[model samples]
Target: MGLTQTGTYNTRQLQIVIINSILVVLSITAVSLRVWARRLQGLGLFVEDYLSIFALALSLGVNALLFQSLHAGVGEHVDTLSTATVEAYSLNLYVMQLFWNTCLPVIKLSIVLFYQRIFPVRSMIIACRSVMLFLAAWYIAFQTTAIFQCIPIHHEWQKKTTQGKCIAFVPFVTTLAATNLCTDVLLLILPTRQVWKLQIPWGRKVGLSAIFTLGIIVCAISIVRLENLIAISNSDITWSDTYSHLWTAIESSLGVVVSCLPSLMPIVRLVKSRGSRRDGKSLTGIGQGSSYPSYVRGPYELSEVSNRVSTGPTRTRLRAGSSHSDLIRKQAGDIEIITEIDQTVESTNHSNNI
Candidate 1:
């Protein structure tokens, strides 16, 4: 179809295709990295991983529906399409909104569930559960409203003059956007304090906290989408709402990718390790003879425990193997016997899954 208002070609579908394509690719990469990280750690898939997968699947459904709507002339001028085409687009758009609402909350819950596992502090876990409950309630409320937004849902697709009463679009969407922003803020703050209390250094703690804080990006996108949503009117919904559509797709897709990023820490550490070895540097995160969070140490199969230093100049070691323990005992003679403590701190730091 040709452009109705501009001198340039109508590139709505093209833009949608490109954005969704990139998003799907990133989603796949994120999940792949999660699986790889899990295999490296020798653990089964966990709840949060399944939740992320569900969210990704819903996102794909939304993408496909949006593309189908475009084919039905959703992004073009309404005058350019037949009555049947318009109806098809309307139905598809409604279905897309259902999937969009579902996808956003699932992704949020996945991240929150992850926090529950990683930070077992009683207060933090309670906060995480509270947020999860809020998200679940929000999803159901918004989805139900969306379904019945108009009296006789089929009227949602009717022509402007023929369409029956529907709730005010601006208020409904604004409420949705505001709730989304609220949740984003809550999720961002949920783990910051807990992470701050970690025994790690100031810089490392900040760095770790920043990862959880990345939800602010989604909040910004939601604000942009709300702006576009407010601009939408009965005058030219399909055309005017294009920006809102664009941001919605972007926000949901970006959320999915960001949610999975924390799970990819193991792969990142591996790359850093290889680079460091090639440069002839000592391996960091391991055998440093200094205590560090196991997650920072990267997911490794090694079973070596660090030697713990006491208050004075004396130090003790934890031995895993009995034969080696005997050899060390023989060598040290009168030295204090090193009690073997299992050095494996569950590396679920990235996954935070039990």
Candidate 2:
């Protein structure tokens, strides 16, 4: 193993610290936004929020464990470290691997749960539930594999101690990376069809698609991380794996941040609303001259509510003197609700007409 040193600090170690530090800040910011959105909506911090917080906490554990590994000489040349220190580094790395596996799925589960609350379509709900189940199974499998991957477990950290054989590290890492990429792609595509099918205009659809596409950033990161993992030589354990370790930290940290963004809709709306007022123009929903409605349902609920009203034999009465814009706004609170109000109102009214 070779070490990169620069002026009193190990370059690899410094890189890990810098990357994980940024991740910690982002993770905290993302979780805070998620919680603030709940408070803004008066949802009072539901289960999904708790799940996200727990995931962030676990991510912090991973970050801390990585730091511990570095302290024990993980980023230095293996020859420079004592056998005992190397063994300690091995143990820290093992714990970090477990936490990394655990944290990713937990954060993903939180995202799925958030989707469930926002998208009420029966099919979408079923899909989200299915994803949740798969994630739960994945979580169990990950922890089990991490725990039992090596014979007699302790040999995982004490590789030189016994003749205990263990799963090949390269294959294990490659497989883990592949599986993570698959899930990332799944999550990235899961919301696209729903987003495109939204009753909003094509421009808005494109804009929204772009937002969901941020998941692609995480996906790209995963791919690079996987490539690094595959390229790492087993000979230089600590030195060669530094890039993989850095990307893993980045991948999980960004996962938490990206998953929490959609939930921050309320905060975004509040900020946009305030900004628009100062410019002498109110934020429009879906179309020209359309003002926001009072009902203020989030984007995720728009389709389900619209579907229910259109399918039912129930006529909707516009609140007295409520204009077309108001009705459109009533169905969804997001700025994109600038859709045609008369059409929506008539359909809703016809559904309810006796």
> Model 1 over residues 1-354: C-alpha lDDT tens digits?
323455443677668778878877887788777777665444467799998889888887876776666666657777767778777767877887888899999999889888887766799888988888888899889999999999888888775537588888778988898888888878878888877776556876777777777888888888888888888876666777666777777888788888887777656655765575444332332111134112222233222333232322212222222111111111110111222221222323242211
Q: What's the lDDT for residue 306 in model 1?
A: 36
Q: What are the lDDT scores of the predictions, listed in order?
A: 0.67, 0.69
TM-score of each: 0.77, 0.79
Task: Choose the strongest candidate by lDDT.
Answer: 2
| Residues 247-351, model 2: lDDT tens digits | 888888888898887767677766765465454333322211122122322211221122111212222233222222222232332223432233222223322
Q: In model 2, which residue pairs have backbone atoms overlapping below 3 Å?
A: 285-338, 286-337, 286-338, 286-339, 287-338, 314-351, 314-352, 315-352, 315-353
